[model samples]
Target: MSRYFLIRIGQSLLAIWGIVTIVFVVTRMLGDPAVLLLPLGTPDSQIQELRSSLGLERPMIVQYLDFLRHAAVGDFGLSYQSFRPAMEVVLERMPATAILTASSLALGAVLGAATGFAAALARGRFLEFVVMCLALAGQATPVFWLGILLVLFFAVELGWFPTGGWDGPASLVLPTMALGIFVAANITRLFRSSMIETLSEDYIRTARAKGLMPRTIFMVHAARNALIPVVTMLALLAAELLGGSAVTETVFSWPGVGRLLVQAIDSKDFPVIQAGVFLIATIFVGVNFLVDLLYTLLDPRIRLGR
Candidate 1:
């Protein structure tokens, strides 16, 4: 078990390093932000001075090595725009992103589980067909488009909720729905499939033959077994939700780290961009690691194998 945990931790750290390295390289390739910081007709000498001050004049390899060294200690440098510590800016927005991620996950999981169970129980019926169709449509739809439609209908046409902002819980409704719809659709399909398989197993048949009620057979026997795979899916879904929030946050103008990253990209703010990507990658990787540990509790085979 100790070895298993060590391996998982090593793998997660490697994944974070790879992702952060990629983002660091990509952000640098987006052009020198120092040039953008100056006036349109600023002297070339002044621009060069600015670049030198910002340390962009250094060789790419040297810059990358320096970044990695500082990053190892959680120092991601300063935000070129806000002049604040880059990670500090990112962390300041973490609460909003965390709220959005948690709310969306909870909403999606509950809806998906309920609809999936219903679809499985009502297989070959109208409810099953309708649920499946909706799930497929939800899966196929792009999150940005969904967010726009939500804004159009709810915030524009009917005015039930605010279009964007972090004013209150009311402001969260649209973005949460936009980000969570795909999660719900995915879980619905997976849970429905698992439930169907569980229902077909001998234990379920025996329970039915022994005069077990429908609810009892499903809640006690089928749902519990069906949830094992879904637990894994939930972890993956959480990572997806966090990644997908970039588009959702941009579209809705939410002041989360995702939106901050978008702004950083537009301005080519290397520190903020790198910090944002690194922080998010670390979080999702850590979430997956924790979920893997949770799986051992759910299934003894995992610990035994370890």
Candidate 2:
């Protein structure tokens, strides 16, 4: 088990390195930051001076190596926009993003698992049809569009909640829903299928034959196995939510790491952008690592160190 964990840790570190490198290279490709940073009509001399100061004047290979060196020690320099440590700025927004991610995941996983299990049991019934249709619609809708629609209806027209801002609990609703609805829809489909398959297995039939209560047979024998796939899906869903939060937060004006990254990109804030990507990637990899540990609990037959 220790060896397996070490191997996974190495792979995760490698993945983070790859993601950071790709983002670093791609960000440079979006054009020189010095040009975007300086005011329009600024003198070329000033722009050149800024570039030199920022080390943008260096060769790309040199800059990348320097970046990697500092990044290993949790330094990404200062934000071009805020003139503060980039990681600090990103971390300040971390709690907000953490709230959003947790709320969204909880909403999605609980609702999806329940609805999916119910749908599986109610297969061939009207309830199943309704759930499936809603799931389809949820999956089909884009996060940004849903956020807009939610803002329009729930905030603009009805005034049930604030359209944007992170004032209190009410502010979290729209963005969470926008990010979570898709997660729920996907999980619903996957879980429903897994449940149906699990229910048909020989062990399930044996439990049924042993005079186990119907509820016990379903909950104990079927639900646990069905949950394994949902657990895997949840890890992937978390990554999607992190990605989608950028759009959702922008639309809703929710202050989060996602929104911070967008602002960094708009202002050509390279350090903040790099820092944000690194933080998000690290969180994602960590989540996947935890999910790997969870597999043992979900399915005892599976061993980790094999």
Candidate 3:
């Protein structure tokens, strides 16, 4: 077990390195941000001066090395627009993003689990059909468009929820729902499939034949085993959610890293963009590691290679 864990840790570190390299290259290849420092018709000499001042004159490899060095010391350079440290700007907005992500994932888990259980339990019935319909609709809708429509109906027309900004919890309702509903739908479908398989297993059959109640059959014999895949899905969703907030956060004007990312793109703030991607990638890697740890707890057979 120790050997397996150590090998997995090395693999994870390699994965992180690969991701960082890809992100770095992609960000630089997008276009030179030095355009921001140039005037409408600036002389070539002045452009060169500004580029050298910002260190854009260096070879790409040298620039990357400098970035790594400063990043190791927690610098992350400066924002193109405000000139504040990129890390500081991202850190300032981290709370709102964290809140939104957690609430949305929690909302997804509840809706997903309930709907999944209901769909599986009510298979071949009206409840199953309705659940399927909801899942279909959830899969079909684009979250940003849903967010806009929701804001229009609830905030503009009906005066129910606020249109944008994170003034209070009241402001979070519509945006969180918009971001989470689809995730819940996907989770529900995955959960339903896993549950159905688990319910048909030999252990479940034995429990049912022994006259155990439905609750006991599910909870005691099947539910925990069925949940392993769902846990992996939820972890992946959490990772994607961090990166995906760009669309939702922009639509709702939430003060989060997602919104910052959009602003950074507009200003060609490469440092912030790189940092944001790395931050999200780190979260994803961390979640997967935890999920691996959870494997042994969920099933001893997993630890024993059964």
Candidate 4:
């Protein structure tokens, strides 16, 4: 198990390195940072001076090496737009994004699992069909459009929630619902399929044949086994949430890392952009690594050293 963990850690490090390299290259490719930072009619000489001051005058390889060196020591450089440490800016908004992601994930998991479980038990019934249809529609709806509609109804019409911003708990309801609903739809489908398969297994049949209570047979025997795949889906869902939150955050005008990232991109703030991408990638890699470790705990048959 220790060996397996070490291997996973190594892979995660490699993945982070690749992400860092890609972000660096792509941000540079966007255009000269000096042009973005300076005024519209800035003189070429002034731009060169600005580039020199910012170390953009150096060779691409040299600049990249410097970036990697600073990043290794947790310095992502000063933001071109904010003139503050890039990571500091990212961290300031991290909590809002964390809260949004957590709320959405919890809401989605609960709703999806309950609905899917019900559908599985009521297979071929009207309730099951209704649940399936709702799941399909949820999955088909775009998150941004859903967010807008939610704001329109809940905030604009009913005034039950704030239209945008992360002012308080009430402010979170609409955005979380928009994001959660989409995630829930996907999870419902996954859980339904997994539960259906588990229910058809020989163990489940034996449990039923032994006259186990229906609830006990379904929840204890079937659901527990079916949860492995559900857990896997949850992990993947976390990564997707991180990526998808950019659009959601923008739509809601929530002051999160995702919203900050969008702001950085719009202003061509290379440092902040690089830091944001790097941080998100690191989280994605870390979550997947943790999920890999969880597999062993979930299923003993998944021996690590195999």
Candidate 5:
């Protein structure tokens, strides 16, 4: 188990390094942010001065090394726009993002699991058909459109929730529903399929033949086996939710990292952009690591094989 954990950690570190390198290269390729930061028709000398001040005058390799060095200590340089530490700016908005992410994830997971479990249990019945139809509609709907419609109905027409901005719990409902519905739909499909396959396995039949209660055979035997793939899907879904939050946040005007990232991109704020991407990438890698650890716990064979 220790060896497995070490290998996963090593892989995660390598992946983060690659993400940082990619973000650095790509942000630089978007043109000099110093130019964007300056006024129209700024003199070349003034631009050069600003560039030098921001360390753009340094060689690419030197800047990259500096970025890596500082990032190792949780520094991501100063934002081109705010002049504050880049990570500081990112962290300031993290709470909102974290709340939105957690709420959406929990809502989606519960809804998906319950719906999927019901569908699996009632396999060919009307309930299964209704659940599948709802899942299909959710998957087909675009998040942005859904968010807008939700705002229109709940906020504008009914006035049950705020249209945009983060103020209180009421502000969260629409965005959470918009983000979670898609996740729930995908998870429902995956879980339903996995459950069906698991139910057909010989071990499930053996449990049933052994005269175990139907609930035990279904929950303990079948559900446990079915969850392995769902666990992996959930990890990937977390990363997707973080990335997808940008669109939802934009639509809802939520004061989260996603909205911050969009604002930075629009203003060509390279430092903030790099920091945001790096942070999201780090979260993705971290979630995958946890999922790997969960795999061993869920099925001891995974640890034994390693």
Candidate 6:
């Protein structure tokens, strides 16, 4: 188990390195930072001075090394637009993104898992058909479009929720629902399929032959087996939730790391962009690692390598 954990940790480090190198190289290879940084009408000599001040005049290798050193110390530099440290801005906004991700995952998992289990047990019943239809519609629908429609219905027409902002708990409702519903839909499909498979296994039949109660069989035997795939999918989805937060946050004008990232991109703020990218990548790697560890805990065979 310890060895497996170390393996995951090593993989996470490699992922972080790959992300850092790619972002660093790609951003630097783009058009001159000075051209974007300086005033449009600034004299060429002044632009050169500005570049020198920002250490942009140095060779690419030296610049990358400096960035690495500063990044190691949490000095991700300052956003050109906000004139604040990139880390500071990201830190301030992170809670909103965290809240959004947590809410989406919690709601999606519970709802999806329950719906899936119920549908799978129903098999060929009307409820199963209806659940499948909803799943298809959800999978086909894009999140942004859903968000817009929800805002139009709930906020614009009914005025049950505010259209945008992270001003209060009430303002979080629409965006959370918009993001979570699609996630729930997908999870439902996964859970239903996994559960159906588990139910058909001979072990389930054995339990039934042993006179196990239906509820006991479901809660103890089938549910644990069904949850494995769900956990895997949930981990992968966490990365998406964090990365996709940008679109949801933008649509709702929520003060989150995603929105901050968009603002950085629009202004070509390298520091903020880099910080957000690194943070998002780290989250992906971190969650994936945690998932691997959890799998072993959930299934003894995993730890024992059965």
lDDT of 4 by residue, 1-306 (tens): 788778888888899899889888988878887888788999999999999999988999999999999888778889988799999999889888888889999999999999999999999999999999999999999999999999899899998998999777999899989989988898898899999999999988898899999999988888887888888888887876664388899999999888888888878788898888888888898888878778787677787769
On lDDT, the leading prediction is 2
In order of appearance, the predictions have TM-scores of 0.94, 0.96, 0.94, 0.96, 0.95, 0.94
Residue 136 accuracy (lDDT) in model 5: 99
Cα error, residue 98 of model 6, in Å, equals: 0.7
Q: What does the lDDT come to for candidate 5?
A: 0.88
Candidate 3, 1-306: lDDT as tens digits: 678778878888777767877877888877777777566888878878877878889999998888777765667788777888887888788888888888899998999999998898988899988998898899899998999999999999999888999778899999889978977998888888888999989888888888999998877667788889999998898887766488999999998888898888877888788777777777789889989889789877787223
lDDT, candidate 5, residue 5? 68
- Screening candidate 6 with a backbone cut-off below 3 angstroms (N, C-alpha, C), the clashing residue pairs are none
Please give, for residues 51-104, the per-residue lDDT of candidate 2 as tens digits. Answer: 999999999999999999999999999998888999999999988887888899
Candidate 6: minimum summed lDDT over ten consecutive residues — where?
297-306
Model 2 / residue 261 / CA error / Å: 1.1
How close to the true structure is residue 37 of candidate 6, measured as C-alpha lDDT? 77
- Measured with C-alpha atoms, the lDDT of residue 272 in candidate 3 is 85
Give the residue spans of candidate 2 off by over 4 A: 242-244
Error of 6 at 62 (Å): 1.4
Question: Which pairs of residues collide in candidate 3?
Answer: none
Which lDDT tens digits does candidate 6 get at residues 1-306? 576667778888888878987888877765677788777898999989878877779998998998888877778887767779988878888888888988998889988998999899999999999998998898899888999999999999999999999668989898889878988998999999999999999999999999999999998999898889999999888786776488888999998888888887777778888888888888899888778778877776676323
